[model samples]
Target chain A: ETSAKVIDGKAVAKQIKDEIKIEVLKMKDAIGVVPGLAVILVGDRKDSATYVRNKKKACEAVGITSYEICLPEDSTEEDVLKHIADYNENPKVHGILIQLPLPRHMDEARILNAVSIDKDVDGFHPLNIGLLAKRDREPFFVSCTPKGCIELLHRYGITIKGKRAVIIGRSNIVGLPVSLLLQREDATITIVHSRTENPEEIVRQADIIVSAAGKANMVRGSWIKPGAVIIDVGINPIDDPESPRGYRLVGDVCYDEACKVASAITPVPGGVGPMTIAMLLSNTLDSAKRALKFE
Target chain B: ETSAKVIDGKAVAKQIKDEIKIEVLKMKDAIGVVPGLAVILVGDRKDSATYVRNKKKACEAVGITSYEICLPEDSTEEDVLKHIADYNENPKVHGILIQLPLPRHMDEARILNAVSIDKDVDGFHPLNIGLLAKRDREPFFVSCTPKGCIELLHRYGITIKGKRAVIIGRSNIVGLPVSLLLQREDATITIVHSRTENPEEIVRQADIIVSAAGKANMVRGSWIKPGAVIIDVGINPIDDPESPRGYRLVGDVCYDEACKVASAITPVPGGVGPMTIAMLLSNTLDSAKRALKFE
Candidate 1:
């Protein structure tokens, strides 16, 4: 029986949070200035609301002041823009986040672009992404999920330079940015999207694989190369009547099979999920430090 | 005895220039407005001067007005910015281009960013590049070299979707953007850079190869898969005793061997080189059409 080491993203995230907490306290002591993250949530979608609440709690835990505005479902686009304008000029708000999936009726790009590039902790700005894609330039912030994936690799001391990395999606938030990040780390990057043929062959060639396809158990054991490192970003749910929730969370990789073939792999529930919030906090802290000229 | 089709960039560029000329005439007839391109040249580099002169002649041939500004090597950044601001406000100028390799004293990024995004015909602006990288969003203009490379593939009727494409280089102008363009066309992309291990092994797997590494005759026949298509963007010069210029320009791919191995390929001097200015003219015409709202 082959035993692969499971990457513990939850534990790593905790370690990172602890580090940020110390830094936040140090800044507060030095300048009497607390980092603040202002979140604007337009709709009350259960999932979005839960995400916002968790973010607020995480901010408070790290000594970051959290400001939140929850508008009704029918709120106009102007209502959201006005709040963003106010936060952009507010000295206390170092980072501004508009909880995503804003009302479909509203222009998503327009709203995202409205956020000041300096205060765009989420790193969704086109200017930020452009800089991230370009060589010899740096983005103001990298999106949370992709940054978390790279952080996991760094914490594990995985060498990315000269490694062959294959990313199994083209998502704006995770897959594309993660590919750019891996390339920046000097990894040879290949992106396999839905249109890719012979994906198993391609996956077999990779020394590192990042699966963000969002399909439950799509990567079988046969698709992996021996000793390859796998980072599964998909948090898919499969029906499980026996479970209390009526469904169980799984990843894009077939965990049982992948564990046998791969040298290291991340678990579904405890993997990339927790790192997102931790990265958000870290970006907010960074933005505050930059704003306050704190070392 | 193997024969492969030569992708003649000069012929194709001529075709594109002819097409742009027709469009320019049609738009002028429809709106009584001609396209205008403003070029800002800094310093006395002979190469930059030649490029500006060629671009002005091309613009004139296509029924477009060309504006030129030449500054001394010691021109301050403010002086350059002042000219850019004036062109940004010029109603007749629909496209603005700042010749690269500015004086050592100037901040290149600051000057490039100062150009208004709408008239950034060079498409070097980060915002334009960011939009190009993002799926479902279009840039105001794509950088000329990368766009010329794609235009060649289209004119040749090469299928990019589901192809395994390998790009050798990561320069912001050619390799990176070309990879994005190929990926957008549904080709699975692998970018092999200086740090990539076993680049030949990776390159052999590609059905399409775009080499912009500026290394003369780096790709050989044995490195290519039979029937694969190649686009060579390298313009490296090697010593040649018989040539009066003392050197001859060569592509990254050894044309002698690659022609026999690949089904189709682009040659240096007559390929990719001429297409850059053609694409620039096309972009200028496009900006004018967009500005005039001509159908």
Candidate 2:
């Protein structure tokens, strides 16, 4: 039997979505405005397409309006810009999200910067990230994954203040922003990256560990401090002949080993993955509320 | 006997200024352009006035044209904004700096935001900070103090990559940005602020320590790891009966104590203080170079 408490992100994400559903209805009733999220997808990447489809369904489930703009692979940067400009001006579009890994020819930074800071639900805007890094200032939206990680910690009543937090990885998307968030909560933060020497020693000192290295089983049971909280953001796939798909998803932390050592942990597949979409919905709703001056 | 080498900031700053002076002359000879820096001082605070005067002197020594705008204490935010707008359009002004601690009535954030990001040599712009925070993206200018801190580390040949660095304090101007800069150099960084439970224990683990907490003698010898490098950014005044001024400046790290423990250490008065202005000049020269497209 696993002695550690499983941090059920799937159930918590569902609870959050249900809460958002009720708020979405109340917001619609009070202001007669439905929260709207616009997704801009370029090219025919099947994975991106699936993500877009899932987001659209989630929007529908919460009674929020969803807008999708799918452009061809050969579409010029100007074509994408034109749509972003329109969405930026559209009052109904409370949030604007551009699917990642746009066409090879496209300038990703330029295209991402084109979205208005107010509608940057992905929290990719430099201004938003900068504000989040600064003390006493808040971002309009924190990137969904990082926000979800903090939400999980909050839900579990895990105290972050004065805690030693170690973040594995330094990706702009998750690692950097999450470190800033944890620091803002008064947790002394240390970020261990690829170049970090003795990574296991650094990871072992953490009261709270967030592993986003994207390396399956990179964080071993020996790397965790006994009774430390682990939020694994990695979802790496490894060959598993026993499975029908011949593959299995595993977190950066070895689940079996970590469960024996850590006091609390988030499982892969059902953990941070589901919370991302929920946070997107929450950001859209909040943006709509701000637009209509709703409390 | 103290064995630690003193990291001489006064001498290093002078060397940098002399180097900048030659570059300024070279640029003028080659491009018929002189670098210009504009200082906007609001109110009549003696300390601010002294700082502006010193800056003007420093600019003159380096052949950089200095423009000063001294506004009355009762000046409106519009007055400052109008000057900043004029300077933004002024091709001669390569850099713009506003004296800190604006009047109580003025919105500091709004005024700081009004400065064009290109000429924001103070590097207080959120966009600049955000770019600095992101991986592989460089800010137009890093805040002077943090930039100076890194420069000192580099000049002293202290290895940052893969090292354990602990920063005391989290001020946006110094500690936060310094941590980001160190992280960018691939060092694992831990920031210990007021809320840190066992700061000394954490600090003792660092190979490099940067203390900017502004608390005189707060970090005792026991807090430092033997042979670690120390960069003290604190310039706090403590009363001294022996001094004619009745007070003397001390750093966050007790120099007498830390000098014995650290392999290398920066002295309070002669260290980070001189480097700030030197970095300001450096940024101004770089901005002018970028503007003129000079290599």
Candidate 3:
């Protein structure tokens, strides 16, 4: 058995946030422009509110001008689109992001598509997606979850090229695009989806594992190669009476089993989740500076 | 040793063109509109010219109207963009194609990006590429070579879903996009590129092999599985003193060896080559009819 290494995502996130803050300060001095971010939060879901608060805190910490648009739970798709159009044309709002899992009445795709590509900090624009798919081409805004996974590998000095990368799931948001990104970097990729009969055996052979299957404990310790790096993207809620929320956050991987086999692995709550909003803030600042012709 | 089934791409191509001709006649009689294609040949390269001429004659034989434009070898990028804009705006023109490998001074990306996504029958536009990458979204144009190979499989009544398919290459034009298309049909895909250490072993394990690496006869007969369907997309020219052209075409798979082992394999010149221009014609017709709102 290989000795396990813990991937310190909290420390890594702090380093990234500090770097963005420094750039943000330079942007303010040179271009007379501080990057501005607009976050649209719908309803009063406690977790969504927490995420929104974290984003606002990150923006403030980075010296970014932050605006929060809180809407009532009964908002319509038209309302969301109008706000998107408003942020789209507003001079001050260079980057716009709507907290995902919007109210049921809202058409998520329609609203997301409405955000102009130039200001789409989330990198969900069709143009950016195509750019990501292009061989040897990297988009300005790569989707944050995948970006964070790659960054976790990079920060830990794990080489992805020529490595066996096993991605669990094939959702456009995570599995598919991450595979594209990894392929561009010259990694040998194997995608295991629902139809796969031997996912554990497939995963156990990975030099690098990216789990976004959203299934709790799907990737067990037994499914990992000794000394593999694990980037878990799933944020599942499990019943835990000891927690005040009446549930606890769990990832797709069983952390205890993985910690014994993986060389480095991220914890569910502190790993990719925090990095997502941080990247949004980073991309927002990028869009702001770029929109102002500063970057 | 398994005997490889001959694919007979030449006969297949002839039959397809004949069928398209009959369909064209019926459409002409039923409706006053005839499919129109615009080909822009910017260089004096003999091979490019021959390809342009072949496309034109194919359209003529099928009773589709062909519009030809031959500019000098040193046409300005602006001049090319202007032509593309004109064709894009024209109501009567249904399809427009610019021959690739433009003059050294010209920007290929700029010119390719100029074609409207709606009229981009080649499916080379960023929007179309983006749409193609999405799991559920469909692009208007599928790239020619990949489309042709898939059509061959479809016509042969080959089921792709759940098959173990391996594509050896990762080019944007062929390998990468074709993998996406095949994945949509539910085939388990494994992409092996130049960095792959054991490509031969990998190919030997696949039920379906799409060889587009452009390395002549790279996939040896021993590497193919019995009853595997192979579509060879490479067209490499080797010196041949016996031929007047001084060169002969060869596919990525050694025909002598592949024919001995593979259940089915496409031939070099007559294989994927002819299907490309045919699909372009189909895309052009689609562009024209959609522009005219005929369907």
lDDT to native, each model? 0.94, 0.95, 0.83
Write candidate 3's Cα lDDT for A1-295 as tens digits.
5556777777888888899999988988897778888999988899899888888888898899888899999998888888888888888887888897898887776788898888878887767888888875557688877777788888889998888888888887888878887887788787878876667876886888999999998898889999899988899999999999899999999999898889889898888877776777778877877788885
Per-residue error at B158 for model 3, in Å? 2.0
lDDT of prediction 2: 0.95
Please report the interface RMSD of model 3 to 1 decimal. 1.3
Off by over 4 Å in 3: A42-47, A71-77, A103-107, A241-244
lDDT digits (tens) for residues B1-295 of candidate 1: 7867999999999999999999989988888999999999999999999999999999999999999999999999999999999999998999999998899999998999999999999888888888888886888989999999999999999999999999999988899999999999999999999999999999999999999999999999999999999999999999999999999999999999998989999999899999999999999988988888878
Question: Which candidate has the highest DockQ of all?
Answer: 1
Provide the lowest-lDDT 10-residue window in model 1 chain A.
A1-10
Q: After superposition, how far is residue A251 of candidate 2 from its true place, in Å?
A: 0.6
For each candidate in turn, the TM-score is: 0.99, 0.98, 0.94
Cα lDDT tens digits for candidate 2, B87-204: 9999999999999889999998899999999999989888899999999677999999999999999999999998999999999899999999999999999999999998999999
Model 3 TM-score (2 dp): 0.94
- With candidate 3 superimposed using the best TM-score fit, by how many Å does residue A118's alpha carbon deviate from the native? 1.2
Q: Which stretches of candidate 2 lie over 4 Å from their true place?
A: none
Model 1: residues with Cα > 4 Å off, grouped in runs: none
